[model samples]
Target: MKTNVYGDFACYYDLLGWSRFSKICAQRLKNFVRFRGKGDETILDLACGTGELEYRLRKTKLRFVGVDMSRRMLKQARGKNKGVKFIHGDMTSVRLKRRFNIVVSFFDSVNHLGSIAALCKMFKTARIHLREGGFFIFDMLSPEGLAGWELVEIRRKPGYTLIINGFYFPERTLAEITIEGFVNVSSGDSSGKTTYKHFLQKIYERSYPLDKVAESLTKAGFGNISVSSFDPDEPIENASRWFFVVS
Candidate 1:
C-alpha cells in the first residue's frame, strides 16, 4: 500500500480551524446547487479534504462523490461518510465516465494548482465531465487577501506538536506554508518522536481577473459564465474569494 503523506496529519487536520470555514463554504455551495443545478442526483466535490463537505451534503437529496489526492484525507473522509464514495485521485486528471450536474472545489483549493496552465487544465477536466448545463463552482484567494499579510509562526498542540510557518509574496500573489514538527508516539519504556515536514505553496492568482476566468471557461467550451461573490447575491468586488459559475 502507498503511504499517505497526510494520513498522520489527517487526525489533527481539523485542529487547524478549517472545519468552520469548510462548513460556511459548503453551505454556500449547496445554495448555489439548489438554485442553478439541474436536480441531478450526482455532485462532485473536488479536493474534498477530510470529507467535511461530503458529510454535510449527505443530508441533502443529492448523491455526493468526493475526490482528493491525499490518501490520509480520504481515509478520514471514508470513516465519516461510508455511503459517499471517496476516491483518491488528482483533481487535474479525474476520469469518471459519468457526468455531474455540479462540480465544486472550495476553500481556496484551486490555489493549490499554482499556475495558470494547471488551472486551465482543471477547467478543461471539469468541462469534460460536466453535463450540458452543469455548473463548475470553485474559489480562489484574492490578491487583496494576501496584502499586508506577513510570515508568522504558530504552534498548536492537539496530540502531537505542529509548527506552522507562512510567508506571503505580494508581487507574485503567492503564499508558501511550511509545517515542521514531531509526532510523539508512546512505547513500552519510553516515548519516541518522529520528525516530519510538509510544504504547501499556494498562488492567489487574483491577477487573472474575473474576465480572464470567463475567457478560460469560454475556451473550455463552457457558456453562460458568471462570476460573483461567494454569496452569489453579492457584488463581485466585495468578495475576497471569486466564485465562478460556468455552464
Candidate 2:
C-alpha cells in the first residue's frame, strides 16, 4: 500500500501525492506470463491500496481480489469499487477459501515484513494460495536503494501539503518514515476557506539480503525462484528495486 489508512492516516491517504502507473505495471505482469507461454487469469493483489491495480486489471479478462491489514483502506477501496472483493487481514497470515493463478504483491509490500520470518510466512501463504505451477510475484527495496534514500521531502498541492522525513536504523536494518500533513477542510468557496486539518503518521519497513530471501522462499517450497532488477529483462543488478518471480 502506498499509504496505510489505519488510525488517522486514512484521512490523508488520498491527499498524499502518489504517481499512477497501474496500467503499465499490470501489462508487464501479464506479458511476463505470456512470454513464458503460460496462462494467468485469476489474481490476488496483496496489499492492494485503494484498488488501483485491481481497477486497472479488471478491464482485462483477469479475475481480481485484494487483501490488506488496514480496514479503512479497504473501506475506501470498497467505496471506489462496489462489486470487487476485498479482505481485511494481515497479509502474512490471512486465510482464503480459494486459489489463484497469479499471486502478486506490488510496490515493495514485502518490505513491510518486520522480519525475515514474517517474509517467509507470507511466502508460504502465497504458495498455499496458488495451484500447481502457479506464479508468485513480489517486489522489495534493495539495500543500496535504502542507503541512498533522501531524508526529507516536502510536497504541496492546492488543498494539501505533506512533509516526509526518513532514516535508516542500522541496528535493525529498518527504515522509518515520519510524515506530517496539512489539509484545507473549509466548506463553501475556496476564497472562504479557513479550516485546516493536520495529521501525522509514522511507518517502518525492513528488507533482507537477496540470498536470505531466496533461501526463505526455497524453504517455503517455492520452485524456480528468480529475482531480477527493476528491468525484468536483465539480471539482478544495482537497481533500486527488485522483482521476485517464483512458482
Candidate 3:
C-alpha cells in the first residue's frame, strides 16, 4: 500500500497547526489509560506520523513504539525522541515481536486503511499483537462529517509550494485527494524547479458503524469493548469527529 497522504507532507506535518490538538488527543488517551489503572503498560502508536503521540507518552515516562510508513516522518520523529523506538512499517501488515497492553492510532490513522478489508486486517493485527484484555484505540471520520466539509485547493510554501485539492463521494463513502507541488532551488545565480503529483484515496468508512466496530472487536477477542467519541466518555454520535477506544 502506497501512502501519498504523508509522502510529501511528512516534513510540514507538524507545521500544519495540529500540534496542540495532537497533544490534547494524546493526553486524553493517557488519561483514559490512567483512569483504568493501566500504568506503565507497553503501547504501540500505529501510523504515528512524526511520533507526536509518542512524544506525549515519553513526557509521561511511558514506554512506546511508533510505526509509520514514511521514512521522512520517522526521521523527524527520531530527531525529537531518542528513547522511543520508531519503525518504518505499514499499520495493516507490520508485526511486532511482542504484544502491547495498549495500541493506539490517532488522527484518523485508521481511516488511512483505505478499505473495509484493510480495516479488518488492521483490527485482526492489533488483536494479535495485543495482550489479553488489552485495548485498541483509534479514530475515523464520520461520513456526514466528510460531506459537511468543503473541498478546496490551497498552496503552502517554503522551499516547496504544495497544492492540495479534495473530492468527497458520499455514495461510496470515499474521498480522493490530489496533491501537486513544486520544489524550488537556487544555486550560483541559477534557479530550478521540480514538480510532483500524488493521489490518495481515503474511504469515509461510515459503513462500518460504531456497533460494527464493537462487533469486530468482540470477534477479535477483545473483551468489554467500548466505543465513544474522542472525548473518551462521551456517547458515540454522528457529529463526533472521532470514534475511539475499543478494549
lDDT of each: 0.69, 0.77, 0.69
- Say which candidate scores most in lDDT: 2
Candidate 1 worst ten-residue window by lDDT: 198-207
Q: How big is the positional error of residue 87 in model 2, measured in Å on the Cα after superposition? A: 0.4
Write down the TM-score of every candidate. Answer: 0.79, 0.89, 0.80
TM-score of 1: 0.79
Please name the candidate that would achieve the greatest TM-score relative to the true structure: 2
Q: Can you give the lDDT of residue 151 in candidate 3?
A: 69
Cα deviation of 170 in candidate 2 (Å)? 2.8
| Per-residue lDDT of candidate 3, residues 12-111 (tens digit) | 5666443556787677777877897457888888888888777776767568888888798898899888978999888878998899988888776776
Please identify which of the two predictions, 1 or 2, would achieve the higher TM-score against the true structure: 2
**Residue lDDT tens for model 2, 7-77:** 56665565563415455567777787677534537888888766777766665667778998887778767
Decreasing TM-score order of the candidates: 2, 3, 1
